[model samples]
Target chain A: MSRGTLALCAAGLLAAILYPLVVRGLAGAGVGVSANYLINVGMLVFFVAFIGQSWNIAGGFAGQTSFGHVVFFGTGAYCSTILHVTHGWNPWLAWPVATAAGALVGWAIGALAFRAGLKGSYFALITLAFAEVFRILANSVEFTRGGLGMLIKADQRPENFQFRDPMWIYYLALALCVVSLAIAWQLTRGRFGARLVAIRENEDAARALGIDVYTEKVKVLALSGAMCAAGGTFYAQKYLYIDPSIAFGVDKSVEMLLVSMVGGAGTVFGPLVGSLVLTAINEGTRSLASVVPALKNVQPLSLIVYGAMLILIVARLPDGLMGLFGRRKSGKRHDA
Target chain B: MLEVRGLSKAFGGLKAVDDATLDVRQGEIVALIGPNGAGKTTLFAAIAGFHTPDAGRVTLEGHDITGLAPHRICAAGMVRTFQITQPFAKIDVRENVMVGAWLRTGERAEAMRRAEAVARQVGMGDQLDQLGADLTVAGRKRLELARALATGPKLLLLDEVMAGLNPTEIAEIVDVIRAIRDSGVTILLIEHVMQAVTSLAEQVYVLNQGRMISHGTPAEIAADPAVVEAYLGHGAAARLARGAAHA
Candidate 1:
């Protein structure tokens, strides 16, 4: 890794370690800070970063844009939730099952899509369609409890992957975010990573150079799916709820794309940077409604602001925040 | 060694390559020459397994490799370069070559060493860190050749490697091609540059409208009446014959 990337990673690590302490210190003081609010924001940032980093494996490095990543996310959420609630399995023990389920689905998608020669927007649409199908199935399925959503009882047990304090959840998310970042870092450094970038740049030339494009793509997709599913398990444990709309919604897929793209899609640190920026924007806009009485009635004003910011970022800084730092010297052809 | 037999490819009603047959021995530079849209690239695609032939067989070192994937064909020791250079525009020159080198070895250090050596072999040693999009047209062509060479192919198919190069650049690439052939890599090149064909190729095959019109030594191909009538036109052939008579 370059000095810049190393420095970024170190800084991120320091911040993650210090974050809970800072929040606790403020709560101890007379700052009127809620531990729950701080934990909520931290969890959101970490989970978004994690899922975005997961999507980056295939979308950024391999240059395969998938609009249905929520399929894997939902798979993880459903698998872990179902196993834990129905089978009385420990959530920690069910984690791998969720990840495996995500990987299997990812492999199947890759096999079918690649064999059919789907690419570009066609691939994106097919993935999106699959997510929609899964969403509807989850809604209608008896095991999933239909559209009512499934909820885990409030059990503050370590073995259950649950905690009495939201701080524990925050710490868990932080650790997972760091691990995902490390994986992304390792991926971009090796031969496998080089092959992914090659396929991204030009599939035909990559194939001519003896890279198995399909296998490499499928491998990355499976890894990506597993990672995203792992994040989904974290989400289910943190929120204690899993619904079709919450787990497999198109909005969740869009959020992953936005986080990755807005931060710098291909870079390891891009998603984290994007997640922080986006969360800050979301929080900032929500606070605006209280400050401005005219905006108090507009519940989705934050979303409108979020959408506008995305457009502006996409148009002006196509490589995202990393481009502003000149870390994207290789150019923006693979930014998609 | 490579052999293409009765290769036929069609796009809807149009036969892009029709019954095209050719051969490249183990240690000679062979040239495939044709005018625009003569299916030279299509034929290369078939041999390289980018396009499945409607009817034919491709063999490498006597092993049947017909209808295989391009990567599989490459693994069988036949590698091809594109007519329009397709560089990994987002990667540096070294990594682009490294992708090909990784074909032979999974180790990063080994691939890096191989990539560097191949880059130097193709006269791109000085531009290892340059991005693919930043290279000049001639530089991109060299990168393409360097990438292919890094794959350690027994048979190399070069498609219009000298197309956009100036005479000086062409001469430089011709020297590289000769060096590669001297190193025991058989070359089957599709070239429009007559000087490159005449100087580099031990034998030449002429193609027109997806069919092999003639195959012979450069002098014999230059004097062939059918090649003259089909590709060179009567005017250029007469001029060529006059020049030949004087020489």
Candidate 2:
């Protein structure tokens, strides 16, 4: 590994270890509800980072933009919620089933799209359409209880994936974020990773060089879907409620894109960095609204800031926030 | 050994390659030459599995490989370089070659060693760390060859590898091609450089209007009246015949 990657990993590890302790310390120091609020924000950051990293496998590393990753997230959320609510199954045990369903769906999508030779914007649009379709199904399905959504009654039990304290949820999100980062790290280093980047660089050249482009793409998409679905389960467990609109909405897809792009696509730590920045901005805006009464009625303040940030990131730092750091002397070539 | 039989491809109403047949014997350097729009590249594309021929079959060592994927064709020990060099521009030269080397070995270190050796063989030893986008035209051409060579192909199809090079660079590439042939890889190259064709190709084939006009030794090809007409006008063909006789 390069020194830069090593440093990033070390920093990530330290933050993961220190985060829970800091939250607990604040609670002990009588910060009370504010400390819990901070824990909630931290958990959101970790969740966004996890989802962003999951999206990175296909979007950043493999150069296949998917505007419908929310399908995996929703599938996972619904799979676990329905199983737990309808069958009284343990949420912890149902988590893996949810993840597997996500992988299967992802594989099916990959096989169909790749076999049909879909790529680039067409691929993106198809995935988005699938998400929309899933959202509609979740809304109307009799078993899913339609638009009313599924709700799991909160109980103070680890087996149920429920806890009265927010720390357990925060820790779970943090652990998943680290795992996602580790997966991304391994991918960018090995032969499989190199082939993915090659495909991203030039699909024709990569094929001519003996790389099986279709299989590699399908594999990455499956892995990415599985990872994102796992995050969906965590979200459902923590929130105890999931509606189709909340789980499979286009807004969720855009958030994943924004997080990874803002951090740095294709870079190992890009998603984590992007998640941190975006989460801070979001929470900061909410605090600003609370402090200034005039901003309360305006609404869309966070959306405006997010739009401006995206413009700046796209226009100035095309490589994401990481591009502002040491400018590596690698060539940049975009085929599209 | 490679054999292409009755390969035909059409784009819309235009026949890009029409029932073309060719062969490359083991350890020999064969040249395919033609005027612009003669379908030399289209033929290469069909054989290399980039384009599925509307009608025909291709075989490597007698294994029928028609309509196979390009990567599968490559895995069968046949690889082709592009006329317009396409390198992974963001990656350094070694990594670009390593992408090909990874076909044979899974280990990064092993791929790196193979890539280094091929880069050195292609006279790009000193430019291992140079980004593909930063290379000169000649350097890019060498990188293209190096990448193909790293794949350990038994039959390498080179498309316009000698184009856009100075005489010195062209001569260097010719030497590299000879060395590649001597190392037991068969070469079927597409070239417009007549000099390189004469110096390097053991046998030469001429294409015109999607048809194989003639095939023979370089000297015979240079002296063929039909070949002369295909290149020069009717008046120049007679002049070339007289000039060939005088020589």
Candidate 3:
């Protein structure tokens, strides 16, 4: 990290810390016109960004490009939900176990796929297949409550991992986002990151250069899976309910992938920027639809715009939105 | 030191490499020369553990590394370069080399330092900041060598480092190879550039039709009729011999 980047990061951190407080003070809590909706939106952006960063770690940095990252996400959600609701385990305790389950699944999948010499599209398709399998299993399984889904009884206590104030959950999301940012930052400066980028660029070359490509890929997927699973736990805690569709949905997978891709897949701040854009579009379209009074739901309007924007991003900005800021110097920052 | 005993590899019905034997002594520079499709790259892959040999052994410093993974073979003190250069295209040259440097040292700073030193050794000192994709053909070739060299290998298997270089570039790389050998890394290179082979190789091995036909000093291998017959068909070799007599 350069002094400029360090200063930028510090400023961004300060801005994030102040955002909710500023919104509450300015708007004075209420409903649609107040800060409440914006606060929720802001919270959601951070949460999605957090999970998207998990996808970015393996898909963007390692070039694993998984289409089924929700497998880990759903796995995490179901593990914690099952343990907390069924086994009477504390959510806090269950979260870690859930995260571990995600990592183990990631490790197993990575070992199976890479060991079989699956590469490129094949590797991606297998992840999608795995996610579908998990989704189906969760749909039919006894402990998961099948299609009915499971819910945590409302116990609004900080110790119970539930919050009376939404601001607290928002802050938690912010903390997770910051930690993930640090992980990405760490990758940019370390040997592990270098090895991953090498594997991403050319696995055969990386192997010939004495990099254990298989181990590195497996390690990255494990790391990615853990981070994603943590997000799953956060999601369940926030919503208090996780059904089969919500937990293992392709929509969440696409959202995670889209945020990373649109922002800047490999960069630390990509998912954050992407989530902000997505939330902004959603709100912007919602307000526009309210004025028009004919739009059935604002979501379709936003989706059209989002779909168009995605095409533009893919066509013009291969490096995502971060490329616009001249962040191509991802290699020059080792001096820090 | 490296040794290969009757290494053979076949893909389905086509025997890509059959019963090939070669050796690189401690601090020696040997050349493997053959026509295109003479199974040179396949043999390099087989020895480097990219391809599993059917019935033979490869020993690096007297340990059997025949069917080990490519990374394990690289760690065991032999690293092979590709005939067609493969660089981390998005990463810069120094970082690309650092990927190999990370093999010995896990420290980022130390690996970067080693990568820089290797880059300089390959005459790529000024091009350190260039992206791997941005390099010219000769630059990519040098990048390949620098990357493999960063691993601190005992033996470097260079697959046509000069395949796409001009004469001057070829001479520079040849000098770089010599410097690498002098600095204590042995080399076993596959070359079509007979000049580089003659100038740099202490011993030359000729492979034809998935087999090693001859092995000797550069002059002796150049004079061998079997080597000529392998490169040119029997009719062409005889005709060339007759033409030489007529001349």
Candidate 4:
């Protein structure tokens, strides 16, 4: 490992060792379990980061920006929710099914869109339109509970992956978050990573160097889609609810992009920092609104905050915050 | 050896390349020269498999490569470089070259080693860690050559590499191409600078109005009426030759 990689691993180990104690200590005090709740929120934030990181494989790394990733998330959620509610299936069983479904959808998209020569901004638009169409379809479909939405009954079952305690959900999400980071690290280090970077830089040049651009691109897209779909399964089991607006919404995709952009799109550790920072701000806004009744009337402040953060990060620090600390001459300094 | 037969391409009603045929022997340096818009670039593209010809057959040695993808063609022991450099601007120079080296070995460490060696060969070793976007035009051109070389190509198609270089840089690149040819790589160069062509091309092919106007030694092509009329216009070849002689 390089010195940089060693330092990052050490820092991550330190954080992992300290985070649980911090949560337990806060729970000991009269902080009303806010720390625990925030930790739970952190899991969601990290989940968003994972989506962002996965999205980068196709969007940032392959130079194909996709705004329809939430479709996979929705599909996973619906698949798991229906299996558990209607057929009494275990969440574990639903996980692989959801992943396969996601991969299939991704392959279909790649075959159609790439073969037709859709790329760049045009690809982004097509993905966005696809997500919107899925959202509309989910809202109209009766099996998805339509506008009534799907809600789980209040229960505690370890096998079902449902509990009254949010801590269990937190641990599960934390595990997924770590796995996502590991996958992202592997991707950016391996030969496949180099191919993606080459294609992103120049497709024609990559093709002339014997890199199969279409096959590599589709493979990355499938990986990204599967990751997002798995996240959807986690989301459904944790919250015990699925709604068209929450599950298939375009805003979810935007949130993923925001976290990735804020962290550093092509960099390995960018999404982690972005998730931590954004989640803290998000939780802080909710707590402040509870304390200050005047802020209760402000419904969309979190979104406004997200938008402003994206703009500020893009304008002042185009390379993201970590880039400011890295050595500039190395050109490994995150500029994008 | 490389062979092309009945190569024809058209844009709407106008033919860009009309039933062109050519062959390049092993270790030979072939120059393709033509007036502007005579379809030299187009023909190169077709040969490289970027464009599917209206009707043609291309073969490397005895292996047919008709309608194959560009990457597939590259894997068959050929690579190409563009007139406009297409370096991976966001990455280091070595990493840009590594993209090509990955074609052969597909092992990161070995590819990187080869990339560095090729960078040094192309006179870019000191700038290995430099961002490709930050390089000067000449540096970018060298990076392009380095990348093409890193692919372990047996046949290299170079398009307008000398277009914007000064006289000194042009001479340096000419020397590099000669070295590459000496290293057992057959080269097909599309060049406008006659001086480099005259110095390096083992055989010259001149195209005009999408047809081969002449094909011979540098001295013979200089005397061909159609090649001269296509380039220097009527009665100008003699004066250009005198100018060359004086210089």
Candidate 5:
């Protein structure tokens, strides 16, 4: 790592650590519910970034683009929720179990799809199908209370994995983001990551070079799934509610993918930056809709803007938003 | 160090490789030479574990490796390069080689050092910083060789590695490959370049219409009627023989 990147990372970390405190200070200065809203927005950025990193791991780094990552997310959310609300297991205990369940789903899907010689679009569609299957199952299942959804008991105690203050949740999201960033960082530096990049570039070539493409694909998917599932659990805890639509929705899948691809897919900070930009756009449009009398209740404006931005990102900024910043030197070729 | 016996693989109704038998003894360079559609590559794939042979067996260092995955076959001490170059376009040449080097060592620095050495060995040291996609055709071919070599394979399979190379480049690669064999790696190459085959390979196997036609020293294969008929049309060998007799 270069000194510049190291210093930049340190600055970013410091800013992230101080974000909540600054918001709290602003609130102390007599800001209204908007201040608390800003805090929530910050939390959303990190939370989305965390799950986005999960998508980035398999889709971006390994070139196994999945359209149904929500399968894992839903699996995580349902697993923990079922355990906590129905089985009477604590959320803290259920978190790890949910994460493992997510990973198992990832492994099963990857193994089946890859072993069947699926790649690119076929692989993607299969993942989407899996998510849909899970969604239908969740809706029809009795333990999940079907379409009624499962709601965790509202107990505002840290011991119960519920907190009275939203700020504590924001801090938790920050920690998850930091950990995810560290994983992405390790990918750029570690042997496993190099193998993934190899597979992404060309799978047959990677296999010819002694990489087990099936094994690596499965491994990365599980890792990504585990991370996403953990995010689902945190999301459930934050809302104290998880329904089929919320847990296994295509919206979360798209959000995760958009944040990663729009920011930068393979890079560590891409999803984080994407989350920030997207959440800002979402909230900014919401506030705009509030102020504008004619456009009141028109939440779809953000979707229109979002659609336009996605097109632009796909067409002009093929490398994602991070390309505007700078390329990682290690990823660049040195000329003879 | 590698032996293949009665290896056969078919794609749909087409028999890509039919009862092909070849071997590479310890520290020897063997060439599999045939005309296009002769199934030389299919045979290579079967031996290297990309295509599971419908029949027969592949053994490396006295251990049966038939039906193993490519990586497992590589771990068992054999690796193959692609006919069309497959380079990791996003990564630099050194990093490309390191993906293969990581097979030998898990340590990044060690893999880096080892990858550099392999690159230099294949005369790609100066281009180590260049991305895989940026390389010229000859460079890509060499990169393929470098990557396979980095795995420290006991037996190396070269699938048409000199297909697009000029004579000068081919000669240079020939020397590099010769040095590799001298350094104790066995080689099984598929080549149409007769100059390279005659110069580098000690044993030559000829394939025609998905079957192994003949195996011998390059000179012997050249003189054989079956080998000549395979390369030319039917009875071209007889005409050549008659022409030679008339001469």
Candidate 6:
């Protein structure tokens, strides 16, 4: 391992150990739900970061740029919900199955599209279509509560993977966030990563160099999907609610892409930074709305802000905010 | 040792490489020479497992690897470089070599160590920290060679490695190729630089209109009428006739 890798591992370990205690300290300081809500927002931020990191395998690293990651998220959410609500199964047991479902979906899509020679904008469009179709199907399905969505038990119980204290959920999400980051880091470091970068930079040349572009791409896609699916299961567990709009929304897909791209798509920490900043901004805007009645109906502001930020990021710092920091250089030519 | 047998590739109706057959012995340096549309690159692509041959087979050390994916082919011990140098632009030269070295070593330190060795071997040790895009054209070509060499390939297929090099750079590349061959690696080079091909290749295959027009020793092929015609066109054939008449 390089010094960089060791330092990252140490930093992650420190964060994992200290985060829960920090949240507890804030609660004791009489911050009330304000601090609790910040922790809540942190949970979402971390979780989004995890999902964004996973998606980067295919989207950023492999240059597949999927807009249908919600397929995995929704599947994982539904599978975990089914296991918990109907069969009374352990959350641990359901988690792997949800991840498997996601991987399989990703594999199927990858094989069909990649084998058929889809890439660039066409691949993006195809993935976007898959997400839309999944959303519509989930909405019309009765077993999924149709448009009504699935609702979990409100009574807090540890045995059921639910707790009275939101802090418990925060710790779980934090732990998961760390694990996801580790996977992302390991995947992008080795020979496998180099091959993906080569494929992304120039597919034909990669092929000429004896790279199995199709298999490499599909594997990354499946891995990314599995990770995102894991995030979905956790998200469902935290909120105790699942709906077509929330679980399979295109907006959520866009959110994942934006978060990763804005932070620095291929870098290990990019998505986490993006999630933190965006979620904080989101929370601040919501609070500002509460303070001023005039801001209540300003629905278009989020889109406008995100759109402007995206344009600025692309035009100025194509690599993202991390590129601005100078701590990391841009990805290699193949990484592009 | 590499053997390509009856290799055929068709893009739509056109057969880019029709019934091409060749063998490269271990530690031998062979050249595939042709004009712009001779399908030398396409044949290289097929032999390296980039393109699925319409028909025929490629055997590396007697393993039938006709339609296997490119990376698998590489793992099986053959590595190829592109015609136009494709460097990992934004990353430093050492990192670009590291990507190739990573194929063999799982650890970063080990790969970087090997990358430095390969960089030195290719005469690029000093430029290890330079980004790929910042390197000159000749520098990019050297980076490509270093990367390919780092993969631990037993057989290397170099496509136009000396395409745009200055005379000094070309000589340096020739030295590197010779060094690689001396290390028990077999080489099959494609080149339009006929002088390099004639000087370095023990055996050469000439391609014309996607067909092998001639295959022989450099001296023998240089004297062949068909070879001269393929290179300089029918006008050259007429010119040769006029020179012979004047003599």
**All DockQ scores:** 0.61, 0.58, 0.71, 0.60, 0.58, 0.41
lDDT of 1 by residue, B66-151 (tens): 99999999998999999899999978898899999989998877888899899999999889889899999999999999999999
C-alpha lDDT (0 to 100) for residue A291 of candidate 3: 86
Query: What would the per-residue lDDT of candidate 5 be over residues A107-173, giving only the tens digit for each residue?
Result: 9999999999899999999999998888888899899888899999999999889988878898899
Regions of candidate 2 where Cα sits further than 4 Å from its true position: A3-8, A30-33, A327-336, B242-247
Candidate number of the best TM-score: 3
Docking class of 5: medium
Question: Candidate 3, residue B169: CA error in Å?
Answer: 0.7
By summed lDDT, the worst window of 10 consecutive residues in model 3 chain A runs over A28-37
Candidate 6 stretches greater than 4 Å from native: A1-33, A327-336, B241-247
Please write out the lDDT profile of model 3 over residues A226-308, one tens digit for every residue: 99999999999999999988988888888999999999988889999999999898888988988887785645798888899
DockQ-better candidate, 3 vs 4: 3
Compared with the true structure, what per-residue lDDT tens digits does model 6 show for residues B1-247? 8998889999999999999999899888999998898999999989887789999989999999998888888888898898888887766788778777877877877888888899999999899878888999889888888888888899999999998888888888898888889988899999988778887899988888888888888898888778899999877877998999999
- Report the alpha-carbon TM-score of model 2 versus the true structure: 0.95
Per-residue lDDT for A62-152 in model 2, tens only? 9999999999999999999999998898999999999999998899999999889999999999999999999999999998999999988
List per-prediction Cα lDDT, in the order shown.
0.90, 0.90, 0.91, 0.82, 0.91, 0.83
Note the residue pairs that clash in candidate 1. none
Off by over 4 Å in 3: A29-33, A297-299, A327-332, B235-241
Return the top candidate by DockQ: 3
Model 4 CA lDDT for position A156: 77
The sequence of per-residue lDDT tens digits that candidate 6 reaches over residues A1-336 is 456656877997687557667766887887665656766776787788888887777887788898878888988898888887777777768889999988888898899899999999999999889888888998997778789888887767877777888777877877777877777676566778777877877786566555678999899888888888888888888889999999999887898898899998777778888888778777777788778889879864567678888999999988888788674433331231
Relative to the real complex, the DockQ score for model 4 comes to 0.60
Q: Which tens-of-lDDT digit does each residue in A1-336 have in candidate 1?
A: 556756866896898778888888898896998867887898889989999999988898888999999999999999999999988999999999999999999999998998888988999999999999999999998999999999987798988899987788888888888888888877676789889999989999999999999999888889999998998888898889989999999989998988999898888888999999999888887889889999999986867877887898899988888878874444232221
Better-scoring candidate (lDDT), 2 or 4: 2
lDDT of 6 at B50: 74
lDDT of 6 at A306: 84
Lowest lDDT block of 10, candidate 2 chain A = A327-336
Model 3: lDDT of residue B105: 90
After aligning candidate 1 to the native by TM-score, how far in Å is the CA of B225 from where it should be?
1.2
